[model samples]
Target chain A: MQWETVIGLEVHVQLATQSKIFSGSANKFGAEPNTQANVVDLALPGTLPVVNTEALTLAIKFGLAIGAEICTHSVFDRKNYFYPDSPKGYQTTQMDYPIVGPGELEIELANGTKKSIRIHHAHLEEDAGKSLHEAFHGSTGIDLNRAGTPLIEIVSEPDMSGPAEAVAFAKKLHSLVTNIGITDGEMSQGSMRFDVNISIRPVGETTLGTRTETKNLNSFKFMEDAINQEVERQIEVLESGGTIAQETRLYNGDTGLSRPMRSKEEANDYRYFPCPDLLPIIIDKSTIEAIRATLPELPEAKKARFIADYQLSEYDADALSSETKLASYFETCAKTSDDAKLSANWVMGDVSGLLNKNDMHISACPISAENLGALITRIKDGSISGKIAKQVFESMWAGEGDADTIIDAKGLKQNSDEAALESMIDEVIANNPKQVENYRAAEADKRKKMTGFFVGQIMKASKGQANPGLVNKLLAKKLNG
Target chain B: MHSKQLFFTSIGLVKPFELVLEQTMSVTKDDIAKVAKLARIQIDAEQVPEITHGINEILSLVDKMQQADTTHVKPLANPHDATQRLRADEVTAINERDKLMANAPESDSGLFLVPKVIE
Candidate 1:
């Protein structure tokens, strides 16, 4: 029997607030272990937490972006648990009444199909600190710098079909959050983290199967891997006459396996109660409008605009506008050159290909988009062939110089002069008389194939600087005669 | 289930029924054990019954305060407005890890080290 994988994601985005959610401690990454924790973060006696205005406004901005209902009155509850990372006995979060209510996100799958994933709710919460396991001589070390950091947990319904759809949903979320300037969307630093709940049931079954939550999957590749592994594990267990258990599993990327945490401490019963210290925040409709007005063009909006404004294909627009930086880079290059299609091809083809090979991002690329745009202009103007343009682009990428400077230094300017190209064509014909006779006697389609020989010879004679269009034109004239 | 708890504002204003419900509430041995476990505290097994009795006695004494009807009293969340003391969200923290970690029972590599946690 076929099996279907059901998946839902709980994403935590660490808000871009300057201070802790309820404390004045610096909300930053890579700080000394406990340095950023202040009295309020440390849960000192008589130290009460005051909500940060930036955190509140950013949460509102996210809610507005999703077109979700912003709860006018929301309370902070205490999620009681015991762990070294959480110095306080309880974590302050929203339970039952979140700041953001029902919403939806439209995710585009790999096959170019769009599916809407339902969002249950999202709430503002404080992040716990880190627990380091390797350095303490069998003891675990805790870094409280991340303690009390502000975060917004977005919960989604189990509407995903498989791992690919789950990843698409996550990528869409990452783009939306970063596009709105709410968070930096850095996966490596745990800025945007995902917890995927995965389960598999027999096909055509309406009831759901027990799921195991794979926690703290930061990278996209890892998230995809974890879901696939968990789905297989559940299916295997079901097929072998075993029942799946509902538990939390950790995906070990090194081993390519998922395993349940130690069972002794598997107790997850959190006694939630309203925190009495702080009052609930009441957000007005005007406040939501004000935040909505501040939102930048989201990913979908920018993609549509790129398609309409530049007359680009849907796929090209989608790929270019997925990330804000890449979209801006494409825009800069597109506007600088006359051939927008050529600019798009160069940016998406050679530029992205080189960056991926070297494991660098577009923002860190050595070649500027302006320089690439100018190089495309040369190719359009017949100053350089596409093949020779690559050579110039490679040199420019290596920090040699701009497009014109590199072309001049290497003498890569294509010889578009008809006289120069005709002489080279004549030289190629004189050297290959046998092949020329063979081509004249052959069928009409046969001589078409034979043109490559003369074109190759002429290109080599010109040291690859001969204009390709000119060479092709000269070759057809001499070969047919 | 009274969701008056959901509203941090507009609370205590509805009626005196919620206050009565809270006043009549009492804890059993199981409730005490569960609450103590959540708070990460340990108590002797022999003291469970004594603690239970003590809590009931204390709760009964506090129940006397609920007898007075103060229907004229207006409900308020705080003395001031709903918004509390305002401070601009800025980073003013200095690195005090060394001083802060001084209180830990054990530390290593600028980290607070404890018994190996299972999860």
Candidate 2:
């Protein structure tokens, strides 16, 4: 019997606020451990946790973006837990009442299947400090610079079946958070983290099987691999007549397996109670509406607009909209050039390929959007063929010159004039009389392909600058006659 | 259930609820020690009982969160919308080698310090 893996992910996003959640300490990363920390972070005597309004506003902004209900009154709770990283004996978080209610996220799978992942709720909490084991003499050192940093833990329903959906969901979430200007969503720096809850059951099993919660999945590859391994582990356990234990586990990338860490705990174990130090957050209707007004065009909406406005294929639009930087660059190029489709093709194809090859980003591209637009415009205006424009683009990419200057300096203008193009077309026909005869005797379908070959030769002879439409018309006329 | 103390007395159970060993979720004192070790914290051995009790209590709280009819509940993934509040996408900050080394536990002129390597 086949088994289906059900997955849910709880992602922790560290807010990009300048200060800590409760203290005035800088929320910056990579600082001296205790230097940026304050008395509150050290959990000194008589220091109380003062909730940051900016952090709370950031949480509400997230709620509005996902169409979740913003709770006017929400309370912070004390999660009693002991750990070296949590300087405060108890972590201050939202338990009984979170600031935001249920939300939803819709992600498109690789196969173009759209799946809606339901968000249970998002709550604001303080992050724990980092433990640097590489430091200290035979002991791990604790850095409280990240301690008390505000984070919003977004929980999702167990709606995903496989790794692809899980990854798509993660990328969608990462893009959404970064796009909203909330967090940098840098997985490498641990700014964003994912903990996926995975469970596998027989194809038609009604009751949910034992689930394994994988922690510290910092990258998309890890997220996908972790889920696949855990699912396989559970399936093996059930197949061998051994019961799978519901527990927290760690993923070992090298071994491609998950090892149990501990039993998963329920929330009540934290002794959660409303934090008395901080007051309940009350957001009025106007606040939510004002936040909604500031939201920019989301990726889904932008992708659709690219398809409609630029007359681009869905694949091209999706690729262009994957990164905010790339989408902006495309828009910038489009603003100056009327050939939006051509611009999309270049940006998504050649520009993207070059950037990937060099391990660069669109923002790091040496070619400015105006220069790229000039290259496309040159092609459209018969100054260069599509092929020569690519060469000009390569020159522009190397910071040599703009399209117009490069074309002039290299004498690469298209031979699109009636006389000039006809001369090249006739030369090709004269050199290959057999091909010309075949072009005459071939069926309509074969004739169409020959037209492409003849056009290619004319453009090649003219150094990729023969007017393609005129070359096609002249070649057909010459071959037919 | 309203007269909870009286009802529990009638059922031969008392206030604070007499937790049966067989049914009390069974987190042993040794398990608590192991959990603290996994969490990488140093706690006095004598404090294990109290810590175990506290962790059990907290775990019960997490249990309550899971029990709440969250069948249709969606988890909030991030607190912000899907837009990057991008800065000028330009490098503005520079790493100060001197100041960065100043705070190091041990350092040399402008480099971080390490223990002697060669004989």
Candidate 3:
């Protein structure tokens, strides 16, 4: 029997606030361990917790962006667990009444079809500290710098069927959050992480299978890898006449393996109740509207704008507006060049290729958007052909001067001079007599194809500096005669 | 799976003595044992019943308060329907690793050292 996989994702995005969620502790990343912890974050006996208004505001922004229902009154619950990472013995989180409820995110699959993944809910919660086992010399060390940091836990419905759809959903989510300027969505620094709940059943089965959660996958590639591995593992167990145990498994990303951290027989009891320290966060309609007014242009809206305003194809617009930095970079280039289609193509093609080759993000690209725009401007004004502009772009990527300077210094401008282009075509017709005869004898449609041969010769004789359109006109005049 | 309630003081302007209905869940000897383990406290088996009896008598009064019949009363996280004061999202604290480590029982390399924990 064929198998089908069921997947749902729970993502934790660290809100880009300057302070901890419930305390005034500084929330900078990579601080010395325990340094960012305050009395409240450290769980001192006398310290009282207070709600972070900025966290609430950002959570509301997320709810508004996704069109989720913003719960007017949400209470904080203490999720009790015994661990060194949580010094307070419990994590303060929203349980029954999450801040956001029942939203959907639209994603585009690699096959160019749209999918709407329903989000079950999203809640605001405080993060626990890190447990360091490697450098502790037989003891575990705790880093409380991450403790009490505000996070929005987005829970998605079990709507995805495979790893590809799951990754598409995650990438769309990352784009949405980063575009809206809520979180940086940096997977490396643990800014955004995911816990995948996956199960496999026989194909066409209506009921759900037992799911085993794989915890704390920080990158998209590893999340996909872990899900595929888990699905295969479950399928093998069932094929061998075994049952899939519901457990919490720790995924080893390097080995593509997972081991059960908590088996079905040894599940921890996380006693949860309303936290008495915090008050119910009462959100009025005015507050939600206030946050809605402050919303930035989200990714889907920006993509639509690219298609509408710039007349870009859906594929090009999606590629150009995938990231905020790239989108703004493309916008700057397009606006500067006044050639939106050309700018979109160059940014998506050459710029992205160079960025990928050099191990850089669009933000750290060496070539400025303004300079790239100027280069495209040269191409538009017939100062340089598209071929010469690529050379200029390569040199500019190597930190050479601006487009005009590169064109002037290297003599790489297009030779649109009519006489010069004609002379080159004359040289090609005189040298390749057999090809000229072949072109003159062929039918109109067949001769159209032979024009490429003469055009190649003319361009080669000019050393690729001659204008192709002018060369084509001059070649046809000389060859057809 | 054990479910037990831990007492936490309400900071929402509710008087401590007036929160009588919060005590409906009476603590049993089993609850005391489970809570002691969760809190990482040392407790003798003989003392569980004594502590359970002492805690239940107070809880009985709390349970009796539930009969006051406040059907129209809304459930509130804070007794007072007061709005919370908002704080600007700013970095008010700085790294004080040494001062913080002074409060820890043990420390090494800017990290709090605890007994080896897995999972």
Can you tell me the CAPRI class of model 1?
A: acceptable
Rank candidates by TM-score, best first: 3, 1, 2
* Predicted structure with the largest TM-score when compared to the true one: 3
Task: Look at candidate 1 and tell me the lDDT of residue A328.
Answer: 86
**What stretches of model 1 exceed 4 Å from their correct place?**
A1-4, A110-112, A200-207, A236-242, A478-481, B1-26, B54-81
The most accurate candidate by lDDT is 3
lDDT of 2 by residue, B28-98 (tens): 68875654553345678887776667656654654454445544744332233321121222212233444
Interface RMSD of 1: 4.7
Lowest-sum lDDT 10-residue window in model 1 chain A = A263-272
Tens digit of per-residue lDDT, candidate 3, span A1-481: 7999999999999999989998889888887778799878889899888888899998989989899999998878877776788899888998777889899998777787888999999999999999998887789999998999999999999999999999999998998888878888888999999999999989899999999988899999999899988998999999999999888888887787788984432436666667777777889999899899999888888889999999999889888887899999999999999999999889989998988988889999998999999999999998888988899999998888999999999988888899878877777788888988887888998988989888887778777888888887777777777
Off by over 4 Å in 2: A29-35, A109-113, A135-137, A262-269, A417-463, A466-481, B1-119
Candidate 1 versus truth, CA RMSD in Å, comes to 5.0
> Model 3 misses residue A155 by how many Å?
1.7
Instruction: After the best TM-score superposition of candidate 1, give how far the Cα of residue A234 lies from its true spot, in angstroms.
Output: 3.3
Query: What is the per-residue lDDT of model 1 for residues A1-481, given as tens digits with 9 covering 90 to 100?
Result: 7999999999999999899999889998887778898777877789888888888788888888888889877777777678888888789998766889889999988786789999999999999999887766779988889999999999999999998999999999999998888888888899999999988888899999888899988889999998877887888899999999899988876777778976555557675666667776677788778888998898999989988998999989989999888888888888888667888898899999999999888899898878888998898898999899999999999999999999999999999899889988888889889999998999997777888888888889999998888788878988885
Report the error of model 2 at residue A434, Å.
9.6
Name the lDDT value of residue A287 in candidate 3. Answer: 85
lDDT of 2 at A33: 49
